[model samples]
Target: MVRLQNPVLKKELKLRFRSFKSFSAIIFYLLTLLVFTVGFFLVVTDFKGKGFIGPEMNVVLFTMLTFVQLSLVLFMTPGLTAGAISTEREKQTLNILLTTSQTSWQIIFGKLTSSISYLLLLLLAGMPISSVVFLFGGISPSDFVLTYAYMIVILIALASIGILMSTLIRKTIVAMITTYGIMLFLTVMTAFFVFVTLSVQTGFDGSELGGQKPFSYFFMAINPLIHMASVIYPEVSESALTVTSMDLPLWVTHISFYVIITVLCLWIATKNIRVNMK
Candidate 1:
């Protein structure tokens, strides 16, 4: 096995830990989860008793919480990764790093991985809260596994997008804005396309017009949020709110494609760095 040297990973992790950005993000997410869980418990308890919430309600709450968490990840991931490389260039540190024995790919991965580690830690911190939801009775162990796995895939995809933007842009501000713009485009535009497609197909019929079909299937396969929502609540497939449906098999295919794309982006970034160095 090839051991990766990542001095920057340790340094960046320490820096991120000490910074308010990481601290605030983790604290904010924890507090939000706590408030939601407490409010949910209170509503259920007030309505009847512990049994009132039931297993289905618990599952619903867990699924909702997972959705909210994924949204947070989507919004914050670009912030973490968009400046990783461009910021180094801005600070005139790229030459120093290039002079070292560390390969460009290693540098890129180290920065990307280190940034993601902080977010993953925050997600893991919420695991106990998620488990507590299980205590109330709706979610299964399989649900937890699927939810976490989806989160991991989402993080990788977002980080790759950010890193690609970082490598392409020289200024940190431009990179940040561009990264976020792309994220918004991906999440919002794809959803809009799905909606428009469905509308044109069924004329707002009650039946789901998208999913495992031609155009709809292609977009649905790529949208992480859509894939996860479908997996958690299959009933959403029949709802007007559901723009697309995605099964576990579709999720796996999407994740595989995203991973391959990320690898390609990393390779390109490495090549860019090497060419610039030369």
Candidate 2:
């Protein structure tokens, strides 16, 4: 949590909590997750037609729930953060921030922290929905915790992108749209490119990591979904997602890529703000 002394963070939090949308967000998230969980159980088990959910089915349920949670956060976080700076500009308060005592980095981070606070709240509120998996007997506490850790990392990464776009675009709507497009590129387009490349190389042969094709692996490392898959299935097959001769797991590279992305985006956004302040 950012210190309350951060005036920007304090102000933003106050504004978000006072707004009706914030309350609506909590209700919407819980209801959506509850509906999905129940719907998945009913459909998968044929309305409990097949009794006794074995460990295998529990694993599937866990995977589904994890991805669903990831999806909800993914869709919501960009909308929250896309206006981080642009909205301030639109309100003519960006200059007001500059005249304050905080540094550029502090201001940007304050915006980011405030934006994500609600998302974190939603994650906490939805835990009971996710915890239902434990009643079966497949997903462990470690897996549950790790899944959340990955979500937070991805959320921060995506929010950083939103912050960068908001800083660069100067319009909330454009920033929001561009942020969504970039996220789509990072997830969908990367997978599509990999599929196409693998298909062309082997005339649609099975996707396998062979030879010294680091570039192909590089693409995989940048996609956040890869990291999620790695966490979901810790015993993932090496040949299915390895970087040929690379010694480390693919997920490590994926996390590293996002970390770099976060740092780089924050730096660039802060630099842009400072330049404008002069």
Candidate 3:
């Protein structure tokens, strides 16, 4: 059974890698990163004697670059997974797979693993670029680990959501659109809610609300961008002088919880495939 699934998985991955869609996306993402990095380098070079590219500056720059990469991953992962199932259906190949002995979980896992492989490849390709920030110093290995962990969690969450949408929708186009729409809603709408709640909870007074409970604190825990931000700019907290603050610990918990949720979502997708396969 494993042997049987291997061919299908390999074929899908090969096709995906060879296709113009994946190639174009990979090129576009890399170009964007290069552009940003060059621009940042130019700006820093302008401040040559002012200690602008010091240790702390390197740390900050690396953090910012990693955050941007994470955001792009979150945005693009849905595109990778959204059409996994729906594309099979569109190509009229899903029925052929359903007739095989492979179980629903196997099929779902194969598709998901294949899709994730591409995203992982793109990420690994950026490692060299990411390492450039290390030359200036101030960026610790622990910080890199934390950033990568947050990014993995976010990618899994987005991919699971995409797979769920793919399982529910019959058409590839519809699935893709729905997947992006849901992610956008989750990110933007949730942030808006947090902003409003925070404003109201703090009474919207001009004075700073020091030590006040963070509005959208719960949502922030789940929001991937917020999680990345917390990991990157951990010093900027809701309150000052609190060494053991809410950023790292809270986001760590959030990452673990969301990873679990993503697994559950994949399970849901597998069950969905079992029911929908005819």
| Best of the candidates, TM-score | 2
Which is the better candidate, 1 or 2, if ranked by TM-score? 2
- In model 1, the runs with Cα more than 4 Å from the true position are 1-3, 46-51, 203-212, 235-248
Judged by whole-model lDDT over C-alpha atoms, candidate 3 comes out at 0.75
Q: What is the lDDT of every predicted structure here?
A: 0.78, 0.83, 0.75
For candidate 2, lDDT tens digit of each residue in 1-278?
A: 54336888888899998999999989999998888888877887789656678889889888888888888888888899999899889999888878878888889988999888888998999999889999989788999999999899889999999999999988999999999998989889987876665565552355654566665666666776766877878655265455344566677787898899999999999999755533
**What does candidate 3's lDDT look like per residue over 38-131, in tens digits?**
7787777873534357887787689678977987897888878999888888898888998788788778878887888888888877877888
Q: Count of backbone clashes for each model? A: 1, 0, 0
Provide the lDDT at 66 for model 1.
88
Per-residue C-alpha lDDT of model 1 across residues 68-169, encoded as one tens digit per residue? 788888888998899999999999988898888888778888899898898899899888877887677756688788888878887887898888889888
- Residue 126 displacement (Å), model 3: 0.3
Give RMSD to native, each candidate: 3.6, 2.7, 3.6
Model 3 quality (TM-score): 0.85
